[model samples]
Target: MNLQRFEQLIAAYGSQAHHWPVAERQAALSWLQQQPDNALYCQAQQLDMLLNQSVAPLPAPQLYANILAKICPTPFRDGYFYLCHWLWGESQWQHCWRPALLLGLPLLLGLFASGLSTPSVEDLLWLDLEQSWVLMMAGHEMDL
Candidate 1:
């Protein structure tokens, strides 16, 4: 129905048309017939022929060993190997959100609640008046 489904059907059954389910093969042929002569159709035919070719056989045991050594080199390399060292070494806590939420949300809530309960202008004025009265009383006592 979709392009992906068409591609899957082609990959699974297109390589050997004779092996395809008869009804499905007929349906696919009918669909391809509906499309005009196009570049994609030509390219698909060429690639299908290319995939069917067989390579020449390999030589002796030494040749096989040489090929294997060339294809599969040593995996370890020094330049970036030390950078891969783990700090916590795969702890289960790294995958968890509960601890971060437990620590973070209360701190955020405390800050938000602190902002809401901050002293008003009137409270500041009263504190200022109290301090001034103390200073005036201290001055009076000193004068006496």
Candidate 2:
């Protein structure tokens, strides 16, 4: 893979490098092994050290309360801010409708516009399949 994509994969694995897919982990490891003096090798070493450091554990009860507070705020049962955050946090749903519209709108507009512009094959009977093919094949006909 390209260096940029390799770097992205490393970043995604983050502090949980061990959690990276086995095949990808091996590939990264192999690439690094092959290039001990590579600039990326130094970066990878720093990243590995960063991943090895331990994070301070939070109290389960406090963590749960914090998560709930963020998801379901205190102002109301259905708080505007909470709902907005929820929608924004999971933006895949927003993109679902967007892609449909992006694809469907162009298709629909093309169909509508075609109706207003061109006649169907049946309507243009003078230019039958045989006649059209002959004209195309004839090129610039003989001078005679």
Candidate 3:
């Protein structure tokens, strides 16, 4: 890997071989062994033990409680689940895409079609001026 990527991997994964990607772990270990004096690697390894010892995040207790509901069997969510999400809020990421596609695609298509059908905004304004001029001529002819 390049110096930047190596430094990134060192910073993100630490000096531990197991923490590194499985495919690259051996290569990184070898590189570290070959270059123990490398200043970049030394800096990255500073928190290697401390950060690893720190607790990794655990999922919410509510998620595990959902498995219990599977045995109890709750009714499936309906379309109103999304419609009411703005007020109650939603946690799951999978809910965002469907609504975006449903609403955004139609809006995008309408704008695209409007642009395609236009004589253009400038042409519409000029047409309005032409109609006004015709009305003024009609008024002048009526007076004559």
Candidate 4:
């Protein structure tokens, strides 16, 4: 195994092959066989010994009770305050964009849709004027 993987394995499994992941155990064993005096293995052995030492841990007294005492209730925000917060904002410039986008996008899309669907006034008022007449046969029914 490479030095990096060997170091990681040592930290994870400790200089012992049995504790190492089953899939990686053979590779680690072969690497160890190839180099009987691996520096990472020696370091891992030292670290394992350090970890195994019977040091009395400091007592964490009232951990749950301390956390509970430190907790402070916050006021709940409704829609009105939320909208006000978004619009006015802590940074007047930074968060102003989201609210502007929310309002402007719909309005812009509406204008674009209407522009495509609605006919123009000029198109609506335009007409074609045409007439047809016969000179000899058209006047026979008129009263004199």
- State which candidate has the highest lDDT: 3
State residue 125's C-alpha deviation in candidate 3, in Å: 99
Best TM-score goes to which candidate? 3
Q: Which residue pairs in candidate 2 have backbone atoms (N, alpha carbon, C) closer than 3 angstroms, thus clashing?
A: none
Tens digits of lDDT, candidate 4, 40-78: 788888878887887897758788667855683334435
Candidate 3 TM-score over all chains jointly = 0.36
RMSD of 3: 20.7
Q: What is the lDDT of residue 18 in candidate 1?
A: 67
Candidate 3's error at 136, in angstroms? 99
Error of 1 at 97 (Å): 79
Q: How well is each residue in 1-144 modelled by candidate 1, as lDDT tens digits?
A: 444554566666554456567767766666666663544555566777887786887678899888977787646543345324332235676435555665689999999999999999999999999999999999999999
> TM per model?
0.28, 0.29, 0.36, 0.33
Backbone collisions counted per model: 0, 0, 0, 0
* Stretch of 10 with least lDDT, candidate 1: 79-88
State which candidate, 3 or 4, has the greater lDDT. 3
In order, candidate lDDTs are 0.66, 0.68, 0.75, 0.74
Q: What would the per-residue lDDT of candidate 3 be over residues 29-53, giving only the tens digit for each residue?
A: 7777777787877776677757767
Off by over 4 Å in 4: 1-3, 55-144
Greater TM-score among 3 and 4 belongs to: 3
Q: Give the candidates in order of TM-score, highest first.
A: 3, 4, 2, 1
